[model samples]
Target: MQITASTVSLTVADVAASQAFLTAHLGYTVQAAADGFASLTRADAVDIVLLARGTQVLPPEQRDRHAAGLILAFTLADGLHDQEKRLREAGVEITMPLREEPWGERLFQITDPNGVIIQFVEWATSDDT
Candidate 1:
């Protein structure tokens, strides 16, 4: 009578590469791995899966074209500087310079090997609020 999303899959050039990124950079635990697929579980029961081209139950054309790269949104617990330091120490490439939004958020974006955008954000107090 009810349904909920348990997992989300995104196409990657290489499953191992994506797996390594999540493991090394984000500290997610790798739950499963196969020839061309890997699954990772983070806190709060969230699971992310990487399916390399030519694999997975998703459409063949979609895999072949690698059309379903995703936006992996991450919220920072500490301040913006802390997030910056962590990502910087990991040697992650910064696609857009960090910017403060008028709505009171400090956000930055970077893309992974599979062309998936990873947006990192932290709360920044608004000037008027």
Candidate 2:
């Protein structure tokens, strides 16, 4: 089977809060929204669906569960440092400062208002490693 698109649905305490964070900081556009739900999209990123905690649309067993211990990581084609600087300059807290791993991975992280961890990564070249 082939996947046409990708989306990540997150159950957040406050849908509006997480929606605002994704739109304002991550360049996501609101595709749709309702009292307790929001759909966000970006050309170069995965689509996002924000659902209010306890929303009935979710199965009973999953309704109360929140997005935790999950890191939504995006690998950038380039300019990882520049993106980090831009986010920092925009008053977005850098939860994890930019650092390079021994395995040639350069990455950083930030936590949204709903406590969703978003990570940006870039791979280093042999010369840079």
Candidate 3:
């Protein structure tokens, strides 16, 4: 089968908080929303669906589980530093500082109000590393 698009569904205590954080800080647009659910989209990133804990859309056993121990990462072609600076200027707390790995990967992270970890990454060429 072929896939047309991708989305990550996160269960949070407050759907609105995650929705607002993504839209205000990460450039996501609301595709749809309701009392306990929100669908967000961005042109250059994976779509996100936030569901409040206890939402019936989830299986009975999973409805109480919240998103944790997961890092939603987006890879960028360039401008990693600029993005970090922009977020900083916007008053977003950087949970992980920008750092380059020996393998030539540069990345940083921020935790949304709902405690979801979002990471932005860029790869350096051999010459630059």
Candidate 4:
């Protein structure tokens, strides 16, 4: 299969709230939006689709489920600290403070209004392979 892009669709209690948070703090722009849905995009990151909870487009069994216990993570080539600082300056609360692991992974996390966890990560070494 040929994949041109990737997207994460999140079932949220408030689509507009998530949309606003992503657009204002995470550099995403609204590609499209309606009463209960929004498609957000950024040039260098995965597209995000926010769907209201209980959206009928999902299968009946899944329609009632909301995004939980999931962490949407972005791995950056560098500037992890700078990104964290920017987010902090924007009044985003850091759920996980910046820390480095023994495996050379530096990371932090934040929770959006809908309780979706987002993580930013960077490698201490160049060998991401």
Which of 2 and 4 is ahead in TM-score? 2
The lDDT of model 3 is 0.95
lDDT of 1 by residue, 10-129 (tens): 777788887888788777898889888888998764588888787757676686756354577777765766766678878998887788887788888877766778888888654436
In candidate 3, how many Å is residue 25 off? 0.8
Instruction: Mark the regions of model 4 whose C-alpha exceeds 4 Å error after superposition.
Output: 126-129
Q: Candidate 1, after superposition: displacement of residue 85 in Å?
A: 1.4
lDDT of 3 at 85: 99
* Candidate 4: residue pairs that collide: none
TM per candidate: 0.81, 0.96, 0.97, 0.94
Score residue 18 of candidate 1 by CA lDDT.
Answer: 78
List clashing residue pairs in candidate 1.
none
Q: How many backbone clashes does candidate 2 have?
A: 0
Q: Which one wins by TM-score: 1 or 3? A: 3
Q: What is the lDDT of candidate 4?
A: 0.93
Model 3 residue pairs with clashes: none
Query: Deviation in angstroms for 39 in model 1?
Result: 0.7
Displacement of residue 73 (Cα, Å) in model 1 is 0.8
